[model samples]
Target chain A: MTEPILSLRQVNKSFGPAHVLKDVDFNAYPGEVMALVGDNGAGKSTLTKCIGGIHPIDSGSYEFDGRPVRVHEPRDASALGIEIVYQDLALCDNLDIVQNMFLGREERSGMVLDRASMEERALQTLAGLSVRTVTSVRQRVASLSGGQRQTVAIARAVLWNSKVVILDEPTAALGVAQTKQVLDLVRRLADAGLAVILISHNMNDVLSVADRISALYLGRMAAEVRRADIDHTRIVELITTGRSGDLGLAPEQTGETGDPDATPAAGGSDPAGEADAIRPGDAIGPVVEPAGPAETPTATDTDDEVPA
Target chain B: MTSVTPEAPQLDGPAEKPAVGGPRRSPADELKGHLQAYTARVRGGDMGSLPAALGLVVLCAVFGTLRPAFLTAGNFANLFTQGAVITTIAMGLIFVLLLGEIDLSAGFASGVAGAVLAVTLTKHGWPLPVALAATIVTGVVIGLVLGTLVARVGIPSFVVTLGGFLAFQGVVLIIIGQGGNIPITNETVLAIQNNNLSPALGWVLFALVAAGYAATRVLVARSRRRKGLDTEPLVVSAVKVAGVVAITAAAVAVLNEERSRNVMVVSLKGVPIVVPVIVVLLALGTFVLGYTRYGLHIYAVGGNAEAARRAGIKVARIRTSVFVICSTMAAVAGIFAASRANSVDPNAGGSNTLLYAVGAAVIGGTSLFGGRGRIVDAVVGGAVVAVIDNGMGLLGYSSGVKFVVTGLVLVVAAGVDALSRRRAAASGA
Candidate 1:
């Protein structure tokens, strides 16, 4: 019902001749969790990097809060209230929670760091996030568990009044308990009225927290469907094959779109389309289990061949 | 969407309470908590300065038992001056080491600066200030060149500094004219190492230092409390302040004793001027590393360069500036070396000077892996190196034996660093 706080239209990015992101459109609405799902090499990271201004989009219009904006670097994105938590978390392990939370944009009174004020703000932010596992704000990040580190990284993003916070595979390395903790925190960020873009490989995580699912299939925008309108199998289908019934790209446009000359028969025969319709009905019971490992290697093999 | 409202109540319940800075505990409980935390941290492989402190104590005990002279007040004063140059240079090395980079040329770098000082002061008849300025400028210039090569030109620091090491040795030889040495006759220059502060002045300085330290702690605590944040317990603060005062008072009292062989001939009983110089540098260095934005950036850059870059820190600039700081400090150390010898030679800051400095930093608990060091590490580590050198000489050991022993000590220090790093990783700390 409400307009997206952050939106990208017809975004394209290239790495030499690879064409990593091609005509991708994405949206993140305030007070909603938008899960961006894809296989490896599906341009999820590239799109997030573009939004965070770590990479300059080759051709795109990035609109924030109803106005076209230009983000030349990470600073520009942060200036526009966009923060990104990379899969690595980007935290300095030697620093304490307060220090890492305010790594670059430290508060200072004159030339000296304002320790009292920074500590106060850090305490309030953690409390506001209901983060209780960390015993002390002064606890070095090296001593923190995986879940606590994720909390610190997410809290760092939220500290600057950021409107859109993008997380890349936040729970990929986390244990089950930690993953649940991080997922809960992700939901809380959205509940707090921030646009949260969650990049995930887990179908359960996507189905659980996401209000809108935007699937990226080999550099193209496959589909952006509401959670209520889609089932787990359909979402996985879209991710794996770039189409689920009538929900995603047409068969002609889906296959070998990056290089049209390489697969001329892919558009005419519609083998992928026939395969999609027949497989979804029969594979619904064991969709996620067989689909993940079985589909990834072949998908990646095709991906590697395209770039070469 | 139905699950959201139920979670709102749970979030608000805990969100209203400050997770840290919870209900204030009694002093005893707070102290217990602090001790437990420290022990836990040690177990987690964050053994900062613990091994160094223990080594210093063990070394002192062993040397004291072996040689009674090592325990005397006169020898204690000797130790300060002996360690001053190495400690000063090691202090500078900490900045470079913090970035996980090595400057092998630091020794020859100091040699070059010392030669500059000797030439300007003795040959050119330059004023003390002018010579000092020239000496420091020489250091800064060397740093800029090394830093530019490493940072801007993308040469590995070890390689760049190694080339500097060989070239600067030649530069020093050229400046000192092969085997020639220049004698420094300037009173002020010579007095930096030879002279001591008056006993009264020493006491006054002790008072000022103690008061300043206590005042800082109290003010910080008060400000923290006023801001409704957690503050260290009053008892803990008092203990820390008392520890500082006790150590300083003991040092001042020991140094203030009559250490001269004959009181009538010449009285030598005050804190060495170098002590204050080291203390000042230590204070300044600690403040910059621990409390300033620039210092935090250095740590961030060292800890994770990509993260730091993404955080908007200029990694190259930090990389370059540290070299500048290291070289400038080496210059100061060179000046101290020249003053201690009362002359400048080609050997000034040559041979084991850089090794001793690097060993001091490592022995003090500065990690070779970087991002985990303090200025105080250099001082403590320098003391370890000084005691070994002084004690070996006192025990009539050959330079060969002493060098082997010191080398073994360095290896042990580095071993502790690597082992502790592994422990940290294992413990997930």
Candidate 2:
């Protein structure tokens, strides 16, 4: 019902010869959590990087707030109110929370840093996020736990009045309780009218908080489905086989013919055929190992369609 | 259980209350909290300047007990001048060391700068200001070259500076040809390390420094309070100010006492001019590292260059600028060295000069691993090194024994640094 704050159409990215992201379309609406899920090398990171302007896309139309734009660097993205909280958090361990929050963009009076203002603003931002675990704003980041560091990183992203906040594995290293805290924070971000793009490997995390789920398989977007319409098994099938039931890429476009340029066939015709290919053991076994290393893309794609 | 939606009122309700460690408690409770926090930090392996402070106290007690003359007013004055060159050089080295980079050429770099000063003033008959400017420019040029090579060319700082260490020694040797030394005849130039401030001026300087420090602390606390942010307790600020005043007053009082053995002759009863110079440098360095954006960027880059880069900081520029600051300070130290000896010699910044400077920085609690050091660390560590050197000399120990002892002391200081680093890693601090 609401228009996407950030939209990417037919996005293509290549790292030299490795076509990391191929015609991947993505969209994130305001006040919604769009969880981008994919297996390893499914171009989740590449897609995020392209959106964050860390990588220049080979060809794509990037629209932000309905305006077509070209982003060549991280500064351009941030200037448009887009921030990425990287997997490693990208925080200076030696600096305290306030210092890390305003590392490069420090508030200054003449030539001197305005410490009180920075501290006050940092406090407000953290408070606004409902972050209660951190004891002090002056405690160095090195002294913070993994979850606290994640909180600081997320707070730093939101401090700039960012419209789109992309989180890369925010809770991959966190414990169970920490994961819950972060997931709650993610929900809060979307509720506050910020488009939050959460990239995660854990299915439970996606199921719990994400309003929409977009799964990528072998650099192609397999499907973008509303969370209410998808079950656990269908999402798994899309991630592994690139197709689930009548949704996702048609059977031929799953790459059994080793054609990299095959156009996605909108929707599948045979629901019975797709259902027969939904066995977890058979689907996952062939997808894990490919026969030829030189033809990695084709080999992996052909292997993905073996069970189907 | 209630279905806690993101729109829950509980979130905003608690946020309206103070979230930074809660509201300020009573004075006693605040003090207890401060003490407990400090203790926890120390236990967590953030030792900071604790080891250096303890070492200074122990060394002073031992030396004063064994060598009564080590506590004399004259030797006390000697400590400031004796440590002045090494301390100045070490202060510069702290910048390079803060980036986890080494400048082996710093010692020889100083020697070359001194040679430039000697040549410009004595050989070319340049004015004092011109000579000083020339010497400083020489240092800047050297820094630009070394920094460019390291930051742009991607050479490791250790390798680039080691090459500089050897090359600059040759340059120094070439500049001071035929005669082994060039004696400085300029009264002003020679007086930097030899002259002293008037007794009245020393106390005036002390008063000014103490007042400035106190005012700064009070103003900062007042500003924080006005903003309704958590401020340090009044007692803590007062205690810190008092500590600074007491140390300064004691030093000034001792230096103001007549220490000339025979008072009828020349009265050497004032703080050394170099003392004020070092103090000014320390203040400037501390201000840059603590209160400036450039300094914050330096720390960020040192802590994690990748993170700094991501934060839009110019990592290469920060790296280059630190080397420039370091080499400029080295030039100042070289000028002081020339002033102290009343001449520039081939060995001006050679022998154990670089080692002494590096040792002073490390001994002061500056981490060799980078991202954690203060300018004051160099000053304190310089005092420890000077005391050891002066005390051993007063006790009539031979240079060989002194060298061995000083070497061992350096190793021990380095060991403390490594062990503390390991402790910090283990504690995840």
Candidate 3:
């Protein structure tokens, strides 16, 4: 792969006796969505906190644009063209959308706020992101729905020449349509050559959007699986059991797995809800009909995830 | 049946039910919510017309009621003389409040400055303008020291300013130097308070102020509308402009009052040059607090210090400069007050100057809580306080009663302000 826009290498962090991150090796190349998937205690928050400069790594090197760099604070991170769209969004409820967007960074003309120009620019920013639900840019943020707030936050990150965007569960609480909107935004962001780091727990969402999946198991790097090689059974195994080795609870039908349960004949993702429309190569989970029993994957399948 | 993912939340209806009904309905729930929201907009500092309209009413009523003598052009001119010094002091203090700090020492600092200037010019045989410049410079020095202490030393402003209050009063005592009061008999200095501009010039100046204020208010309201902001009705704006014109005309009439045709006519002669200084200072204060980058930072710091710091604002510098401005303005006021009185005593700025200045700001509708208020708050507030004092003095009230009345006014104004805020907060505006 071409040199990553940023890389986190062998990062270690500890809070007293609790080791939060252990020898983490992570990288994001330009125009790629790198998904980090882990259970609650798998150190996702700690890793991102380190990246966002909320917490400094106890030891390790962070490389950005081919050089080892230190980001000790949010300001430093921003100065390096790294932006994080925090879950809480950090917007003032009392202010209108445009005003909240430019709270401290107001555009000025001579002595005045040059408010007209700022409003026009804010409108353009919103429109550029395809945000259209709200009727007025001057409407107070308090009156906006959750999805709109999320869009605003994401738009703010990308508006300021940001090269690396980290979104923490961007669709965690959004409705299905809103989630669809956000997913579209993520794809567009990466398509425009910006590296996007997506942190999520929803397997369906990870499978749908991520170009590659990196799993962290109890503060250690568990595995990294590129999209083409992924199968649902392997992903579920990695997520639930932290291993793809079959536990021997069921039959071994390992070799070539294909998703036949959902065919494009079922309403597809294009306009229609086609379960079958997922990529032809995607491996559906081993079918366990109520009449049938549980199954396990063989030893060989576990090592298949390591990209060549 | 296809089992759908619970992703499509009941999307359409969260907007429908909240048509803003009153929890305690006064029969018109929708209208009530709209009205409450309007009031909230004003209290939140999102709009300026409310204060302007209310201030105009208060100015008219007070001048009309207290002294039938108040409407004459001569008395109206005298009103400017009364308002001049306080306006300057208040203008400066607004800067301090913008940075969410306070200067408790200004009243005393101004007293000391006034005393020094009067004594130096009259008793020590100094030229008026030279003495004024020197006095203003000393005030600036005092401002710098106090600002540095509060800004650099990390001392709470309350303690620093309280110290200034005490230390400066002592300086005032030294300057007076065993004298109860030193008279300023210099012609130029005395004329600052007593003299008037030509009538045509005075009326023209009044017209200019009225026109400038009206024009600015209209342009601003229009700009807010152009940005798709909620704006007051044009009729409301027109009424506001008319009220300003009427008040200026009435003031001219008050200054033209003849309490005595028998002796030298007790008429307000001309616009006190001090009036223009006060007006210019106030306009500058308003502009800096509302229009400039420094103003936005000040409000940001006041609204939330952590947020301001996180936004990379230099909070310490803003805080220090606020104190400096407050004290320096007080010094300017001292110059005017001492000149007007034709003397300065060690005790000139004592007892009620600070209290009244603060009270005037409160009454004029500047919020004590930092994020809210306007420069005009101080101006209106000063006028209210001045009216009370001047009217009471003319009506033969004793100083004791004056103290009681001033105290009462302060309490009432503060209580009303607090009540309105609580009401707004509860109403979800």
Against the native complex, each candidate's DockQ, computed on alpha carbons, is 0.32, 0.30, 0.11
Model 1 stretches astray by more than 4 angstroms: A256-259, A262-308, B1-18
Worst 10-residue lDDT window for candidate 3 chain B reads: B13-22
lDDT (0 to 1) per candidate: 0.84, 0.84, 0.68
Q: Order of candidates by TM-score, top first?
A: 2, 1, 3
lDDT of 3 at B48: 34
TM-score of chain B of 2: 0.95
lDDT of 1 by residue, A1-308 (tens): 57888877667676664667766668899999999998877888888888988787777678899898998787889999999998888989888999999998999999899999998899888877777667799988887878788899999999999999999888888766667778888998998999999999999899999988888887777778788879999998888888898777656446533433321111212222222231211222211111111112122322412331
Positional deviation of B318 in candidate 2, in angstroms? 0.9
Clashes of 3: 26
For model 3 chain A, where is the 10-residue window of minimal lDDT? A263-272
The better-scoring model by TM-score among 1 and 3 is 1
Error of model 2, residue B203, in angstroms = 1.1
Ranking by DockQ: 1, 2, 3
Runs in model 2 lying further than 4 Å from the true structure: A260-297, A300-308, B1-18
Error of 3 at B415 (Å): 3.5
Q: What is the lDDT of residue A265 in candidate 2?
A: 24
